[model samples]
Target: MGRWEPDARGRLRAAAIELFSERGFDQTTVADIAERAGVTERTFFRHFADKREVLFEGSQVLQATVIEAIASAEPGTPPIETVAAAMQAGAGLLQGNRDYSRLRATAIAANPSLHERELLKLGRLAAAAAEALRDRGVAEPAASLAAQTGVTLFSVGFEKWLTDGAVDDFALHIRESLAELKALTGDA
Candidate 1:
């Protein structure tokens, strides 16, 4: 090899992005990615359950962060406010990782399979957010609505941050987006 490849997870993710971008997710194969990453097929399998997981890496951590943010929020806070607070906490975890984040998101958005996984991640985030709010005794659709709204706002904010080329602070955009979403939903 000309250049030493990255670790298994890194290699897998990079390979996925490249392959998905080139041939589309539906057309790419594990053998293709393994070949590109200079790793064995077993190595790729070790790091990711499938090609889609490579594109959607770190989602488990993200979900945990969003959920933990809500759990760590102060009592009596409104549901949307808690979600915003959690997003701020989670964004701190992603600080200075903008380039990689943008690259990963763009690759996912470029492929239907990855996009579906992205939607599933967002849905899980919403459910987790709602569970956290439910622990706070917020009732019924309020918690569900707030959690879903928060997830949507977070996605909007993240996309804007990636594409707008104007803002650099993910957390600040999340706050602004949450505020906007709240106002739009009459939650504020």
Candidate 2:
């Protein structure tokens, strides 16, 4: 409302989520999101590539967080442990964003195209993670397996955190998911 407003991207994102929840992702347009945020369509476009981009803008940052964590992990740490640490590191990005995350997840779940896009983003993240693991000198199958498995566990943890509403700690859920994975694979 002032000349010095902060977080225009956040405002646009919040408005987009609200509009999508009320009108459905397919029904919501970039113009609608901009109006709701009290910004112009140009402002919306400046922040997001399109309406769908609002929901996925954080994916790139999240992937970078995971990859950096993997790359910086101790030299001899097991691949899975490195992944769990990476998941934990990535979790910080979404911390205290539970409500926005829940709304985004709901919108993604209700749309087939959005769901496919989400899967593609996750796949890319997994690929990046695998490449990071290889940089750590992990062998082929082990690196690939650990990366995919980490993505799966991270996905499950995020779902639980977003949907439960009562869960206050996203990282804890991720760590718990990793523990379960380790237990299942007898790596615990």
Candidate 3:
């Protein structure tokens, strides 16, 4: 399956990024993405409802993975610490694919449509996290605030690392960002 189909979703995403970057997101069609992936348009739809989804895919996976990571964190860890640990896990998930991230980030930055979708993806991820926090026994505002703060730290850490050519360790950057956030809000 990893050979023939070879993660159809991933292939579609890579193809969509390349096409969007080369031809502009608005100009690129699902067929273009499918062709670039050497797959059928039907295959593209199977993996994603449309081209916008190609950019948003990781946000969904990230949310789910982070939630699982948080759920499995040591019981003694504080709620915020658990969330931070999950963010570190997410950073790990993205660390091996800097080139792909650069491509997607550039593509999103260049295209207004992609940018909107990216923002929506971030919001959805935060909301999902807040729901997970509630399940983990966190209260109202704290749950939402903690989740959004985690997302913000992740975003700042990612950009800082990316701008510095990923020189800093991504996990460490997130931890520092979280500390800075705590200092700013006096939440720590």
Candidate 4:
């Protein structure tokens, strides 16, 4: 087919991740990602603001998924359980993207800036979660604590899922992680 084909966004994301993994995030350019994606620089820019954004484009969606999950929960749901439910709901985002997720994690881990960006994204998710919890009538430190705890659980679960090639279900990893967290706290 032609060079400027369909799935420009997906192509750009995949291309950016591959290039970032091979050449390092700082060394890789938007033009390089565009070329690797078989598209033009304009097409790349249309999909992502910069190479850094390629790694974080899903942050908003992930946050939104969690927030929506929290909002949809029963009014009487406890704070921690609300957070856990939201986390499990958001696991759908990573469902079939294990290889890509692993590559993205590796790419982010290798670069301080990328790692910072990831932390910032997680912070945003936590803040959004806290806000959602507050909307559910949860007060101050408890909301923040539950939200951060959920983020921690999700991060740990994602790492375990990436490292354990045998695990195919991302949600299962998250549920297991949540169970582990409860066990650790003697709440299980």
Candidate 5:
């Protein structure tokens, strides 16, 4: 790895995760990540705001993907179903990155601050989804309920996807979780 490498961003992300895993998130610093990635602190800053940002850089993209799916869903689709489909679409971003996802999850789970940050990220995603639903003419409580449920479904499904080594389809896990939710609500 070199400072001139084409995937400096990718290298920085990988290095950050690696360092976070080995040193723990609290122990790892931007300088450590930059050194591990063979880049300057300036290069690392160019890629991310801070070490924590490396773990959350994809959040905006994930939210955007979910919002787009919700906006594009067929007219007359149920709110829950639309949000579920949107979450599934968002899951696509994590496909083929299971190993990294698992490592990232581990790192986040180990640190209280990281866990709080993760929760905040999920909250933002849900809020954005709710707004998208409102844009699609979904009513207030229904939009918020569907968006919150969808975010919960996504969280459950993502955990299952990460822990179940044999399963690779994130959407399937989400569908299964949604089914379970429906069963609980007598909607199954």
Candidate 6:
């Protein structure tokens, strides 16, 4: 692959994940990723601030997708249900990338810093969901509770989706997790 090839950003992300998987996150460097991607260090910097950003670059898109779903949900929908649906909708963005997601997850899990960054990204998503709920006129505790719970559901569901070789639909995992939550709360 040439540095002038299309999808330099994608190539960089792929290279970063591959290097991270093969060499360990802490052992990998920007130069290594750039070399693997056949791009200059400047090109990598243009696409990502650091190696960690390669893994988290889609967080904003994920957050926006969830927020849009929440905001566009039918009026009068229950807060929890709205958030769950929003999360399920957000899951669509990850649908075709299970293998990539699995590798990314493994990389994050192996590094404490990456794990913390992942948690922070989830926290931001939750906060964004909460704000979207509030925009929908949901009350204080209800908005926060629903948003936090939705994020938890997404986290657990995503793990199940990653680990379950037979499951291919992320939305299904989210729905199952939501159902399990409802059952646990005696609301099912």
Q: Candidate 1 regions off by >4 Å? A: 1-6, 182-188
Q: What is the C-alpha lDDT of each candidate?
A: 0.80, 0.89, 0.82, 0.89, 0.93, 0.93
What's the distance in Å from true for residue 116, model 3? 2.3
Compared with the true structure, what per-residue lDDT tens digits does model 2 show for residues 120-182?
Answer: 999999999999999989999999999998898789999878777677788899998987876
Better of 3 and 4 by TM-score: 4
Per-residue lDDT of 114-177 in model 3, one digit per residue for the tens? Answer: 7887888788878887888888888999889888888888889888777776375778889988
* Candidate 5 whole-model C-alpha lDDT, 0 to 1: 0.93
**CA deviation > 4 Å runs, candidate 4:** 1-4
Which consecutive 10 residues in model 3 have the weakest lDDT in total?
A: 160-169
Tens-place lDDT per residue, model 6, 21-139, is 99999999999999999889988898889888899989999999999999999999999999999999999999999999999999999999989989999999999999999999999
**Model 6 lDDT at residue 41:** 95
The regions of model 5 sitting more than 4 angstroms off are: 1-3
Model 1 score (lDDT): 0.80
Angstrom error of the Cα, residue 57, model 2: value is: 0.6
- lDDT of candidate 5 at residue 45, scale 0 to 100: 78
lDDT of 5 at 176: 98
Provide the clashing-pair count of each candidate structure. Answer: 0, 0, 0, 0, 0, 0
Question: Could you estimate the TM-score for every candidate?
Answer: 0.84, 0.94, 0.84, 0.94, 0.95, 0.95
User: What tens digits encode model 5's per-residue C-alpha lDDT throughout 16-134?
Assistant: 89988899998998999989988889888777887889999899999999999999999999999999999999999999899899999999999999999999999999999999999
